[model samples]
Target: MSFETALKTAQDDIQATLTDLLVAFDGPVGDAMRYATGGGKRLRGFLVLETSALLDVPRERALRAAAAIEAVHAYSLIHDDLPCMDDDNLRRGQPTVHRKWNEATAVLAGDALQSAAFEWLAAPLTHPDASVRAELVLTLARDAGATGMVWGQALDMAAESAEDPLTLEQITELQRLKTGRLLEWPCRAGAILGQADPVHLLRYAADIGLAFQIADDLLDVEGEAATVGKAVGKDADAGKATFVSLMGADAARDRAHALVKSAQDVLLPFGTRAATLAAVARYVVTRDK
Candidate 1:
């Protein structure tokens, strides 16, 4: 199937699973849940499914994990747009969770969504392997928590000072932790679920994670807010560190190309099974949104 078709299928599955889980909650929790989960590219979830497919893991078996990753992603976006953070009023072309609802509701909603991700992952899988489930939950937590994405956020916030202008290496490192970790985790989790070789899984995760970040940087430079569904030029306006900021736009584009090539190279061993993922890496940099 085409990457777009595959992405849509994965997104539909994630939305269905998230809806079921959200319905169990009540009040502002439910509203926040709906708002946060409503619209997204579902990139993280797509990574899970694509990686699982490459490793021969059944799509049905990987659905819960995909949904869990998306839950965490949505929660992060909600919190990231809060007044204390980026303070953006728009996301996916709509008012942010905090703006749509009260601040407390948005905060609680983000917290609830984060907690729900772990709960979903920890729930029983059909394989009945307690060890596997535990590992999955742990992997997601480490990637989403302070040691990973959160660390990246802290670094990003800290780098906002004019005197603290980031080097190219520092910008890359920040993206790896902040934006790339979550993308990497889903692929790694899918590989683990499929019982693939650990070494190969790690390599795939690293490549895709880096590729995802490069694409994001490229998008920030060239994309439109109407299509991208997030504020553009905010990076420059905020004096934030970014690949585009460190390298000129042309250099950043070239770097993104290299990352995509590296990502595809790592997946060569998986042959045609990894075609979708390879395409996705290219699409990531090439896409306007």
Candidate 2:
């Protein structure tokens, strides 16, 4: 199947589980959580399914992990859109959680979603092997906590208030932690479920993850808010440093292209089995949003 078609198919699978899981909860928090997680490209979750497919992982375990990732992603976005953070008013072409509901609702929903993610990961149904489930939980905790996504976010928030702008190297390190880590996890999920060596997919993930951030930086510079489905140009307005800011647009674009090329190269060992992932890497750099 074509990349877009395959991606959509994956989205359908992930979203159904995501919706079911959230709806099982009760109260306004559950309502808010469902709303917050309702829409997006589901790219991270898609990575899990695609990687699972490539590795021949069982569908049941893969789908659970995919849903788990989507929950975490939605929580991150809800928190990221808070007034104390990016203060985004829109997401996925709809009102951000904080704007649509309230800050308290958003915060509670995000917190609950995060808790649910761990619960899902810890569930025995995700994998028959207890060790595998434990590993997923432990690794996710590391990547999503102070050591990874949160670390990057703290750096970003600090940069906003600092007297001096962050250097290019600093920005790169920040993005790697904030965005790249979670993206990498979905790829690793494939190997985790299939019980295969993950070295190559991990490398492929690193390159594409960086490319993904670079592309986001580019979108901030070149895309329309309507098209991007969120407020665009905020980075520039806030005087934040990004790939485009550090390298110049031309250089940044070239860098993203080069990263995508290397990403494809890393998957050579998997050959055609890696085609979907390779397409995802290219799409990361090329997507308008």
Maximum-TM-score candidate: 2
**What tens-digit string does per-residue lDDT give for candidate 2 at 1-289?**
9999999988888878888777778887888898887778888998999899988988778989888888888899999999988888999899998888899999999999999999998998999899999988888888889999999999988998999999989998999999998999998888888898889889988999999999999999999999999989889998888899889999999999999999999988888988989999999999988
Predictions in order: lDDT: 0.82, 0.90
Off by over 4 Å in 1: none
Alpha-carbon deviation at 55 in model 1, angstroms: 2.6
Clashing pairs in 2: none
Candidate 2: 10-residue stretch with minimal lDDT: 19-28
The 10-residue segment with the lowest total lDDT in model 1? 123-132
* Clash numbers, per candidate: 0, 0
- The alpha-carbon root-mean-square deviation between model 2 and the true structure, to one decimal in Å, is 0.9
| TM-score for each candidate, following the candidate numbering | 0.95, 0.98
RMSD values for the candidates in order, in angstroms, are 1.5, 0.9
Per-residue CA lDDT of model 1 for 1-289, tens digit only, reads: 8888887888898888778778889998788888888868888888888888877777776888888888899899888999998899999889999998978888899899898888888888623677778888888899999999999999988887548689888887988899888988888888788877656656766766776676677677778999988888887777777777777788877877887888888889888888998887887777777
Over the full model, what C-alpha lDDT does candidate 1 score relative to the true structure?
Answer: 0.82
